[model samples]
Target: MSNEIINIIADRPFNEAVQDKYFERVEAQLTEVFARPRLRSFAKSGGVLAGRAAETIDASVVGPSLVVFEERLSEDDKQDALDSQAFAEAVVNKLPAETSQEQRYMAYNEALSAIGWVTESYTYKKYDSKKLTLTMNDALLQVLETVISAGSGNVLSLVAAGFDKLKGDKEALKIVDAGSKESSVVSFKAVPCIVAPGGGMAMVMGGLDVFSKDYDGDFLFFTFKTEGVHLFQAAGIRKFNKRAFDRKRQQVYNYIDQFGDGLFKKIAG
Candidate 1:
């Protein structure tokens, strides 16, 4: 009889804690963005769309089960969360005299901090003779905008465009019949190579592992009416501000170069 070796532990080079924290941050922001009523309906309807493989996250639609998670946060439920976030920022600006509930307040506080954005309330903190002004550091505020615009210009624009299209077609997207389902696709990467060999959109679905690492994607489905699907890169070029993207990319690279101390190599995605 042959003996088998025991399980081997794998090396994890990346900081898992940092990764998880960022994932939560990204997921929360996406959820808030998708809570827009029109998007909620498009996602929940489980519509289909033509798409190509080309990014960190592939087609707008992926596995079937994601529709369930997409449906979990109803518009009314998510609105409460958004309102709480705004209220938390308001409270910070107001500087209430006493500390509030530890858990709830901590969550809201963390959410705002994660965004690194702050609006300075005109109200001042007065000391008998003088008033003190507090706000997000002006320099840091610019950095925040750089990071946000980088994301918004690239990935977020595609998302926003998809939802905008879905909103227009809501009346037609019931998702019950096969005919409607076939018409729901988002058509992500529409290139000559993808269309050649008669594979079309179906070819993209087969090689999906190349495009998306995530098992479930962020969309449902759809057909087009003057809304031609294009390459995310091409779309990014058209819809996003190139100067802004370059600036942000440079800023990020500069940060790593200045402080990496040889520990950091590069940023991948």
Candidate 2:
């Protein structure tokens, strides 16, 4: 899929004018998302939610398993995480002795409650590999049309030459907090040194940011977000149109999150 996109963008004019600009725009948003204060808080409290992977403490969330923080606990709340064994026993008593399954689940809930979980909203997430392939092909097809004119012929030497142009963007890179580079490639791009738009664009940027890092030496990747978009839009590349496509796709994912199983039935129908 990526190789095909690369071939289309490999047109010299498009490479010089189109590719780096898209990467720069995406990178900017990723940098912004990664830099949020809450991320630092998450790192500082890194010991949290690590051990709950196997437990289903609450049906408030419907995932097979995922541990997410609802909120932060106050100091007194932290201190009050007392005698979980005792609380677990109390939970065991509250259920019928024959209902071992219910008792065990309730005990887990007691443990979670002793911690600082103060909220109860959930967004269920799922991914379809086949759908993902279709989506990628569709996105790439549009990108090719944007770069290649109707009669523009035989400019083929596999033009989408990766992100070799990223070196230019790196010269101006304002890297901050050298020590905070995230081990996770995705999280690293959305770090605070960049910007976030709080929507699908931000997500696309984050994903691209991770991609650049993951394939750093393999491609000419860069991220610029708003700056690159504005520059390219003014120059007639319509990079923002690509962003709109990404945003619209993201909105569909979000809709599915809210609709959950009902949406899945419609999708599979």
Candidate 2, poorest ten consecutive residues by summed lDDT: 230-239
So what's the TM-score on candidate 2?
0.16
218 Cα displacement, candidate 2 (Å): 8.0
Reference-based TM-score of each model: 0.17, 0.16
Candidate 2 CA-lDDT value: 0.21
Best by TM-score: 1
Give me the runs in candidate 1 sitting further than 4 Å from their true place.
Answer: 1-74, 96-142, 149-151, 154-269
Model 2, range 160-192, lDDT digits (tens) per residue? Answer: 111112123332121211211432222111100
Candidate 1 local lDDT, 1-269, one digit each (tens): 12321211222233435435744644443444323222121111211111211212211221110010112333432222222223233333233334322232333333332332121111111111111221111111222222233433333333334333433443312221111133222212110001112221101000000111111322223211212211111110011112222222322222222222212111111
For each predicted model, how many residue pairs clash, with residues at least 3 apart or on different chains?
Answer: 15, 24
lDDT (0 to 1) per candidate: 0.23, 0.21
Give me the displacement of residue 215 in model 1, in angstroms.
50
* lDDT leader: 1
